[model samples]
Target: MSHRPKTAALIAYAEALLSPEGQRRVEAHLAGCEACRAELAAIEAYDALVEDVRSVEIPTIDFASMELPLAREAEAVSRQMIAQRQRRSARPWIAAGLVAAAAAAALWWSTRETEPQAPPRAEAPVEREAPAPVIAPEPARLTPVVTLAAGEVRRETADGEIPLELGAVLDEGARVGTGAASELHVRLADGTGFRLAASSALALARAREDEIRLELAQGSVGHAVAPLSNGAAFVVLAAGYSVEVTGTRFVVSALDGTVGVDLSEGAVRIRPPRGEPIELEAPARWRSSGGAEGGAPRPVSVRGLEAPRVAPTPVRLADARMIRWSVDGIEIETSGDVQLGLAPGEHPVRAWDARGRLHTALLPVGGAPVELSAGALQADAPRVRAGHLDEADLRPVLSRGMRQVQRCYELALRQGTGAVTGRARLRIEIGLTGGVQRAQVLGIPESSLTECITSYASRWTFPPPGGPLTVEQPLTLAPTQ
Candidate 1:
């Protein structure tokens, strides 16, 4: 057999083994391996030799076309045939082509198969569902043990101390910002129980019975009975008032040298100076010229004690001998001495306890007293048109000789995190030495900076030299994103 290559090499070129005319060339080669590939390089060499031979005073001519002698032409034809036969053999290129074709097919098929799936294993994480919603616990339903904090005092439920630093616990969720207040309700290791709400100023007196008793030394405090008992009693010692609590939750606020008690649902009795008693049923209030006999309100703690009962039907503020008691609801009139009436329930009474003063105490029957008193007569300052005021209306820093007077420019506002919207323009008059200092926004939600400014040129009185004038702009804040 002839040393012939297989058609796969042609197919490899036809597919790998082929070109545009590669199939025809391959078929022809298959038909006759004798016509395998002819080498043009040797033919060109023969043409150059013919040129050299004829260049001697003559032009070149095709030696193959010339009618040369028969023996010489035959010899040349045989030699050309031999050279063509030699070129037909592909001893070198056939082996290399087979190896290259095999490698190319293997590589193309291997890479495209399954490699794409591997990289996708590192895809982004899928979102997970959020946990279930947590219900805000109901105050009335918590287990008695869980109702109070391990060490929460004064208020209802206290977890780790409240975010608030100093606060007076009025009722369950109700409280006031006493100048300062601290509360604790810690469970004892032995299962014994203790609770405390230190007033801005505190006083502790001996107690009796299952009741919690505290003497209002010179301040006021709120207390809850031990172990979630209903009949918890506390004492409030304020400037000119004293109170004895029975079974209930109440808060006593001592401010400006006075004590005011507000009962949420429990009963407390107002004990005026000299051990006089004025009973306050739930929601009743009782206030006096002072929380304690001779001092400002102070916190009093009386645990495990009975509420001190007045032997006789105690004399109340209605029976204030030195300070007569006469009232038309909140507005009370006193001539020579101060008049006080301890209403039935909680009340925030405002009293004008000046030598010749009248106080308006809006007593909430059994609540705390809201007192409103007039300072020494203040002549009314002139008022200006609201549109005529501007930032210059702010009081000028006083100058004494070469010295400059300075005061803290406080931007007073309601400290809260909730948002509130405004629907109307609100106007407020800030009180000053003479009269209205600045007219500003009240109860209208706006920019805090805008409230600090005046609509026109205004004059204000900053007392002494370093004190600030209060801006009576009411604001509201709400909770949102």
Candidate 2:
């Protein structure tokens, strides 16, 4: 028996109104049966014709005679069937009844044509009420973009450290950092600008369309907030203090155990862990030395900082045994107090206490010596040092490196000789400065491309380590068309 689909099945398939299993059956039947295929095509054409007719506007329809043709056609077909039955059975009454019905239909049509026709009347204008006004919805907010990044800057993600570059997009919960001699600048989608000072870290706690919150982990950040909409909030948080502002230009710094809020322009409210919130206007400065101990904030001068001149100076310290000092990146030994001739300028000074806590300060020198006391130092968060790269640390680096290599391989696929598909091993040596000191490819064929890959890997930098270290990574590249 032929397994062709019926007309109804073909129409259902054409309209896509069949269930998945039914459609599959119809499709299978149609594939082998040319007759079913022809039927489906005809059904589709009929559907299209019906849709076209529905779209056309027929200005006038004569409902008075619309059903007359249908009735006449039905009667004619009935009469023909009755006449055929009468011929077989010799029924005279059926023939007479069919002839009478035919004569009545003909007389009705004749009278309908002879009757006088009336003139078509014009339709009255339609009274359409105005449509309701449509209100457009607000546009969606976009993620913030990095407008500028200078000096040494990097972003620490769950995966690994990614060097910050201009035009980088920062999402919420991103942690950004700048090195000792580096600085970073960023702008939000709303045109608010942030300047991050050296050796500083800032985490984007939240960045929404209506509100923005940033947490300063260490160092200072200067913000030039733009005008915001009503109910909008911009907040900066530190370990012991929070600064809330609607729109303002200010600086927030977390140094040692002290938190400082300096307002360059506009106004902001500084709320400490304890004590009344301190409100400051433009050109005002407030400093709190003791965190959580309820340190009173006092107004200070709004003086601009100048670059210090270089000169040999004497260094004074309190409790030298409890601190290890470094001047201009050089470790210095001080027994109580020492006199050393140094360049006159802003010097980067770092001290590590006996408890392994690191403190950073800037020493300005010209003619007189610099004095550093324990109370004036800014202590940073504690650091965890490991002898070698742990699995946790190594995983992100591998993942990030693999992504970089994949990008490079994709470029190679567009620009190079053949598809590179193999596994390559790299042994990299990292310096204490968090830079790749050396990179060597092992177990891979020596070629210019391999050297280029090594060169690319050598540019990868991580956070500075407590000591120099070496790590080996294996990379697998798949063939790209």
lDDT against the true structure, each candidate = 0.36, 0.64
lDDT of 1 by residue, 365-408 (tens): 42233232333222223333223223345334222200210011
Residue pairs clashing in model 2 are: 256-378, 256-379, 309-344, 309-345, 310-343, 310-344, 311-344, 312-342
Please state the error at residue 360 of candidate 2 in Å.
32
lDDT computed for candidate 2: 0.64
- Candidate 2 lDDT at 174 equals 86
Best by TM-score: 2
Candidate 2 residue-wise lDDT, 360-388, digit = tens: 87877755656666676688776545435
Off by over 4 Å in 2: 1-142, 290-481
Best candidate according to lDDT: 2
- TM-scores, one per candidate: 0.22, 0.33
